[model samples]
Target: MIVLRNLTLRRGARRVLDEASAVINPGEKIGLVGRNGAGKSSLFALLAGTLHEDAGECLVPSVWRLAQVAQEMPETAQSATDFVIAGDAFLMAAQAEAHAAEASGNGERMAHAYTALTDAGAHDAHARAQALILGLGFRMDELNRPVNSFSGGWRMRLQLARALMCPSDLLLLDEPTNHLDLDALVWLESWLKRYEGTLLVISHDREFLDAVTRVTLHIERGKLTRYGGNYSDFEALRAQQMLLQQAAYEKQQAQIARLTKFIDRFKAKASKARQAQSRVKALERMERLAPVLAEAEFSFAFNTPTGLPNPMLVLRDVDCGYLPPVGASADTPPSLIVRQVSCTIAAGQRIGILGANGQGKSTLVKTLVGALPLLSGGRVEGKELSIGYFAQQELDVLRPRDSPIEHLTRLAHTVLPEGESRREQALRNYLGTFSFTGDMAYQPVGTMSGGEKARLVLALIAWQRPNLLLLDEPTNHLDLATREALSVALNEFEGAMILVSHDRALLRAVCDEFWLVAHGRVTPFDGDLDDYQQFLLDDARRQREAEKRARMQNGQAEQTSAVRKREYAAARQTAAQLRSLKRAQEKLDSQLHTLQMHKQAIEARFAEESLPVDEITVLGNELKALNEALDAQEERWLTLAEEIERIEAASS
Candidate 1:
C-alpha cells in the first residue's frame, strides 16, 4: 500500500501539489492523468523516491521493490541480452558468485553455487530476456548486438524491456507506449495485464489507459482526485460534477442578489431596519460557492484547399525506400522497404497506414511525400496537386531558435500569391488560431515543450492549404485534448490523407479505409482495428511456432550417429561420477544454508540492541569465517555442474 497525507510538493517556484492526499492499495492499476506540465511526472518522481515532498508524509512499504524506465540514453558495449539480464539483480549476483567460485577451484563451493543458480532460474534467464526483446520488436539476430548500436527510440524500447525484466513490487511507467508500434503496444497491453504488482502509469494515450488501468488519478489545480474506473469513466464523472457545481453556484448567486435588493429598498425605513440588518448579516454569514471553471477546449480546422485534385496521387509498382548515399560505389543497390506498391489515392480519401514497426509504414509515407526517392516504378501527381507532410519527428520540420511567427512568415513567403506581401501581424493572428497567442507566438521553439512543437507542426501544415496530407505518427506528443482537436480537424479536412499512427482513437475517428504495409507489400486490409489486433496475435503465434521448429532442427543437426556411439561409453562413466558429485553438492548446500541462517540471526540480534564491544568483535570474526567456508563450498558445487554439462553435451 502507498499513502500520501496532505502532501505539498513544489518544483522551483511552481506549486504542483498542495495539501493533496491519495491512497493506492496493493494490486491496483492506476492511470495518472493531467494536462501538460500539470505535474504527473513530478508525482511519479515523488513515488519513486527521487523527489521529496515539501510538506507532509509519504508512506510506502520498506520492503517494496520499485522499477521504472531510465530516461537517460544508455551508452554501453554490452550485449542486449546481458543488459536486460542485469535488470534481475538477484540472478546476476548469484551468477557472479558462481563464476568466482568456479575460478577458485573449490569443488564443494562450485556445487552449492550451481544449486543457487538453478534456484534463481539462471539456466533459462537468457531465453526469458530474449523473449522480452522480441516482444519489443527486435529481431533474433539483434539479440547479441551491442546496446550502443541501436538508435535513440530503439534504445528507449530496450530501457522499457530492462525495466520489465526486473521482478518488482511497484512499477512506474510514464508514456511507455510512445516508442511502441501498434503491434508491440498490443503485446505490451497484454503483458502488463499479467503483471502481479501495483502499476502507476502516466500516459496521454486514452486507449492504452482504458486497456490497462482500472483507476484514474487526476491532478487539477494542485489537488489530486481519485476516480473509479478508467479515463473515459473519469471524464464522464468529471462532467457530471462540473454540471452540479455550476448549478449550485447559480442558485447561490440568485439568493445573494435578492437579499441585496431587499436591503437597498428597505434599509432606510425604521420598521424594516432590523429586518434589513438581519438580511445583511445573513448575506455576510452565508457560505459562498465559486463557479466551476470549464476545461480549456481546443478546436481548429484545416484551411480549405485552393483546388481539389481528382486521383490526388498514384503509385504504379512503386519501390518505396532510400537510395544509396552520394559517393557510394556504382554497384551499391538502393534499400527498399516496400516494393511493387500500386495504389491510387483519390480526392478526400482518408487512408490509415497499418503495419508493425520497421515494416515500411513510414517509408511509404516518406516516398509519397517526396522525402525519399523511388528507386524504381512511377509516382504520378494529379493536376494542381499540393502536398503537406508531417514527419513523426517534429524537429524535422521545426527550427529550434525560430519563433512560431518566424516559421509562419517564412512559409508564407514561399506560398503567398504573386502580389501579396508577407505581413508579420497577419501571420501572428493565424498562429493564434492554433493556441499560440500573445507572447507565445514569439517564444523560441527551443524552449517549447513537445506538445507545443507538435501544435506548431500542425499549424504549419494547415498554412499550406494542400490538397493532400501525409501524416506519420502526428499525435505522438499530443495531449488528449489536442488529439481530440486533431481528430475533429481531420474529419473535416477536404484533402486526401494517409495517416500512420498508433493512436487508435484518431485513426478510427478520421480514417475511412485502411492499407496494410507488411512483408514488403502494400495491400488493403478488409477489417478494422480489432481485427488488426487479432491479426497481430495470430502472426506472433505463428512466429513462435516457427522458431520452436527451427530450434529443434538445430539441436538435431548437432548430434550425429558416429559421435553418439563414440560418447555412449564415456557418458556411462560420467553419469556414475555425476551421481557421487551431486550427493556431495547437496551436503555442502545444507551446510551453507545453516551458516546463512546463523549469520542472519546474529545480524538481527545486533540490529535489535547494542552489544558489548568484545562480544561484537568475537561474533564478527565468526561471521567472516562462515562466509569464507560458504564461498569454498559454492565453488566446489559449480565445478561438478560444469563437468556434468560437458559430459552431457559430448554424449548428445
Candidate 2:
C-alpha cells in the first residue's frame, strides 16, 4: 500500500500538481489519465522515488517492491533470459550449478549442493520460474536468446517479463501497452485482473482501463479526483460536473450584471449610500470560481473534390513490401512482407486490422496507397478514388522543415488544383478548422510534440476530403480527449476507412469489423485469437466442473479409480473444446447478421440519394465508381459463407 499526503510538484513556474492527496490500497488497480502536458509521468517518477517531492509526504511500505519501466535503454550485455531473471540472478545460477553437481553422486559435491540449494530456495524456484516464463510468451527454445539481438519493442517485452518474474506486491506500469500486440496485451490484462498485488498503471488505452481497473484516478485542472468506476463511468460523472459548472457560471454572470447596475444607480443618491456600500463589499468578497477553465480550441475542415467514388478501395491478391533501395547491385531480393492481401472496402465501412508488430498491416496499407510496391499478385481495381493515408512514422512522409501552414498549403493543391486563389483560401480555411490560428500555423513540424504532429497530420488529411482514409496507430501517446474527437469525426464522415491499431477501445468505438488480421503468418495463437481466448476460459471452467462431477459421481474424489479419472479428463477436454467452438460460431453468426443489415441500410440510402447528383454527365467517372461499391460488401459476405461452414462443423 502507498499514500501521498499534500503532495505538490512544480516544474519552474507551472504548478503541475497542487496539494494532491491519493491513497493506493492493497489489490486495488488505479488508472491515471490526463492531458498531454498534465504531468502524469512526472507523478509516476515522484512516486518511484527517482525525483524529489518538494512539499509533501510519500508513505510507502519498505517491503513493497516497485518496478517502473525505463524509457531509455540501459547499457547491458545480458541475454534475454538473463535480463528477465535479473532479480537475484547470481543465486539462480549458483543453485542451477549446485543441482547439476549433486546429480553426479559425489560426497564433496553433494555437501556443496545442499548448502547452495537451501540458500537459493531451489526447491520451489523451478515452479516459480516456469510460471513467469510461460506467462511472458517465452518457450523452452527461446529461453537463452541474447537480449541485444532483439529490437526495442521485443526488449520491452523482456523488461515486462522481468518485472512480472519478481514477486513484487506493487507494480507501477507506465504505458505497458505501447509495444504489446493484441495477444500480449490481452494476457497482461488477464493477469492484472486476477493479481493479488496492487497496481497503479498510467495509460490512455480505454479498453485496458475498462478491463483491469475499478477506480479511475483523473488528473484535471491541477488536481486529482478519484471516480468510482471505469472510463465510461468517469466520463459520465465528468459530463455532469461540466454541466453544473456551466450553469453556476451563467447564474454568477446574471447576478454580477444586476449588482453593477444597482451600484451605478445608487452611488449618486444619499438615501441609498449604505446599500451601495454593502453591494460593493459583497462584490469584492465573492470569490469567482478559479478563473473559468478555458476550453482548448480545435479546428479543421474537409475540402472534398466533387468527383469521387462511393466504393473507396479494392484489393485483389495483393502482395506488398518496402523496397530495399534504388539502383542496388545484383543478387539482392526485395522484402515481400505482405502476401496475397485482398479486401474490398465500401463506403461507410470502418475496418480495423488487428495483429502483432511485423504482421503486414502497415505494408498492406502502404500498398493500397501506392506508397510501397506490389509484388507478383492480383489486380486492385477502383478508378477515380481519392485516398488520405496516415502512416505510423508520419515524419518520414511529411517534410520536417516545413511549417504546419506550409503542409496545409501543399495538401490544398493536392486536393483542389482547379484555381490558384480558391486553393489558397481553401488552405487557410482548412487550417482554421483544425485549431491552427495565425502564428501557430507557422510552427515548424520538427519542433512540434508528437500529439501536435499527429493533429497536423489530421489537419492535412481533412484538407482533402478523400473517399478512402488509411490510419496506422493514430492513438499512440494521445490523450483521451483527442481520441474521442477522432472517434466523433470518423463516425460522422461519409467515407471508407482502414485502420491498423492495437488500442482495443478505439477499435470498438470506430471500426465495425476486421478484428482478425489479413493472414495466419503473424502471431501464433492456440489458433485464432478470439477463439483461443474463449478456449482457454472454457477449458478452465470444464476442468473445474469435471472435478466436481467426479467427486459427486464417486462419492469421494480421493478414492476414485484411475480408469474413472482418465475417462473424466478426456471427456472434460473434449467437452471444453466443443463448448468454445460453439460460442465462437454463435459470435460469428451475430457479426455476419450485423454486417448484412449494415450493407442493406447502405443500399437503401444509395437508392434514395438524388440520382441526378450522380449522373454521368454531371459527376463523370465518379458515379460509376460509387456503383461498384454498392455490390462489394455483398461479394465479401458471400466469400465468408464457406468459412462459416468450418466454424459450424467444429462446434458440432
Candidate 3:
C-alpha cells in the first residue's frame, strides 16, 4: 500500500499540495486527475522519486519495481524491436551476465547465467517486444525499422510500447492515449485491464479512465482526495458533495448575516451594549465555512453559418490516397489508400470515422477537406458550402511567431466578409470567449501549450462560419474541461460534421452516426461506440489467430506432412531442409540487425563529449565486445547462406 500522510509539496514558491493526504492500496488501478498546472505530473514525479516532498510523508512500498514512459523524445537508430526489448531492465541484466560468463568460458557461471536469461524471458523477448509494438499500431513490416525513421507522434508510440514492455509492480502512464488512434486506444485499454500490477495513469480521456480504473485520486485547492470508483462515479459523488457544501455555506452565511444585523442595530445603545458586545465576541469566535466555488463553466457555440447548404458535399466513386511522388512519370498511378469512398455530407449531420490506425480514416478526411485530390472520382460541393477543417496537425499551419490576434486577423482576411471588424480589441474580445484574455491573447503561438493552440484552431474554424466541419483528432491535447467544452460546442454546431477522434466521450457526445473506413472502402457502421469497441476486439482476435496459424505452419511444416511421406519423400525432405536453412538464415539476419543497431547507439553516445569519463570507458569496452560478437555472428550468417544456396542448387 502507498500512504500519503499530510504531505506538503511545492514547485518553487507555489505550494501545490499543502497537508494533502491519501491512501492507495496494492493492485489498485488509479486515475490521477486535476486541472492543468494542478500538480498531477508533479505528484507523479514525486512518486517516481525524481522529486522530493517539501514536508510530511509519502510512503510507498520499497520493494516495488516502477515503470514509466520517459518524457524525452528519443533520438536513436536502433531497430524498434531492440529498442522495446531493451526496456526490460531485468532481461538486459541477465543477457549481459550470460555474455560475460560465455566470454570468460566459465562453465558453472555460464550455466547459472543461461538459467537467469531464461528466467528473464530471453527466449520470447523478440516476440513480446513485437507484440507491444504491433499493439501500439505499428505495422508488422515496420517492426524492424530504425526508431529514428518515425515521426514524433509515432516515436512517442514507440516510447509507450517500450514502457509497456517492461515488467513492473507499479506502472505510471501520463497521457498514454494522446498519440493513439481509437484502435490503439482500445487495445491499450484492454491491455491495462488485464495488467495485474498497480497502475496510476493521468489522462483526460474519461471513457478510458472509466474503462480501466476503479479508483480516482483528485487534486484540488492544494489537497488530495480519493474516490472509491471511476471517473463517472467521482463526478457524481463530487457533485453531491459540492451541493451539500454549498447548502451548508449558505446556512452559515444567513446566520452570520442575522448576527451582524443585530450587533449593528444595538451596538450604540447603552441598554443593549452588553448584548451587542456578546454578539461581537460570538461573531469573532465563529469559524466561517467557505463556499464551494465550482469550476468556471466554459462553453461556446459555433457562429451560425452564413448559409446552411443541404448535402454540403458529395463524393462519388472516390479513391482517396496520395498522389505519386514529385517528378514521377505521367503514366504513374496515384497510391490509393481508400477506394470507392462514396459519401455525402448533409446539413446537421454528425458522422464519426471509425477504423484501426493506418486504415484510411485520416486519408478520407483529407480528401473531404480537399487536402488530397481524389484519384478517380467526382466531387461536387454546394454553392454556399464553407468548410471549417481542423487537421490533426493543425499546429503546423499556425505561425509560431504570431499571436492569437494575428492568427485571427490573417483568418479574417481570408474568410471573413470584406468590411468586418478586424480590430485588435474586437479580436481580443472574441479570443476571450475561448479563455484567451488580456496578455494571453497576445502571447506568441510558439509559447502556448497544445490545448491553447487547439483552442486557437477552433477559434479560427468558428470564425469562418463554415457550413461543414471536418475535425481530425481535435481533442488530442485538450484537458477534460476543454474537451467537455468542445463537445458542448460541437453538439450545438448547426452544421454538418465529420469528426475523427480517439476520445470516445467526445465522439459519443458529438456524433450521431459512424462511418467505418475499413478494407479500402467506406461503409456506415450500424452501431454505437460500444459495438465498435467489441468489433475492434473481435477483429484483433481474428488477426491474432491468423498470425498464430502462420507461425505454427512455419515452425512445424516438416512435422505436419507425415501423411505424404511415402509418396513425396524426396520432395518433402528437400523442402524441409530448404525451409530449415532459410529459417536459420532469417533468425541470424534479425540478430545481426539488432546487434548493429546497438553498436550504432553506442557509437552515437561516444560522439557526445558531455558523457562522463567513466561512462565513456564503459561504452568503449562494450563497443569492443559488440564488435567481436558481430564478427562471429557475421561468420555464422555467411555459413548459413552458403548451406542454403548449396541445398537449393542440389534440389534444383
Task: Please give the CA lDDT of all the candidate structures.
Answer: 0.88, 0.69, 0.88
Q: Compose the digit string of candidate 1's lDDT tens values, residues 1-652.
A: 9999999999999999999999998877899998888899999999998999999988999999899999999999999999999888778878998999999999999999999889887988888799899989898899999999998888999999999988789999999999999988987986886676899999888999988887899998899998767798789979998999999999999999999999999999999999999999999999999899776777788989999989989999998888889999999988878999999999989999999888999889988988888888999999999998899875555888999999988888887864434677778888889999999999999999998999999999898888899999988888999999999999999989899999998889999899999999999999999999999988887887698669968774665778878766776777788678667766765675576557656776668666888988888898888788867875776676666556644643
Residues 349-382 of candidate 3 have per-residue lDDT tens digits of 9999999777898899999989998899899999
Instruction: Decide which is better by TM-score, 2 or 3.
Output: 3
What candidate 3 gets wrong by more than 4 Å, as runs, is 329-332, 417-420, 545-652
**Candidate 2, 1-652: lDDT as tens digits:** 6788888888788878888888777767788888877878888888787777778877889877676565666446775656666644445667677778878878898788778767765555555554455555454455666777677777777777767666667778988887776766777886775555788888878888887876678887667887766677678877788788888888888888898899999998999999998999999998775434745734333454444565566667776776667787676787878666666777777877765456677777777788876776655546777788888787457777888878877756665557863465656666766766677688777877777788888877776667788898877756777777887787766777888887766777777766444343332223333564565455445655775777778866454598779866866776676566556644554454454345444444556656565453544454444446434643443344434444433433
* Residue 352 shift from truth in candidate 3, angstroms: 0.6
Candidate 3: give the clashing pairs.
Answer: none
Model 2, position 143, has a per-residue lDDT of: 63
- Order the candidate numbers by TM-score, best to worst: 1, 3, 2
At residue 491, give the lDDT of candidate 1: 92
Off by over 4 Å in 2: 74-77, 87-141, 290-305, 320-338, 396-402, 409-429, 437-439, 518-652
For each candidate, what TM-score against the reference? 0.82, 0.72, 0.82
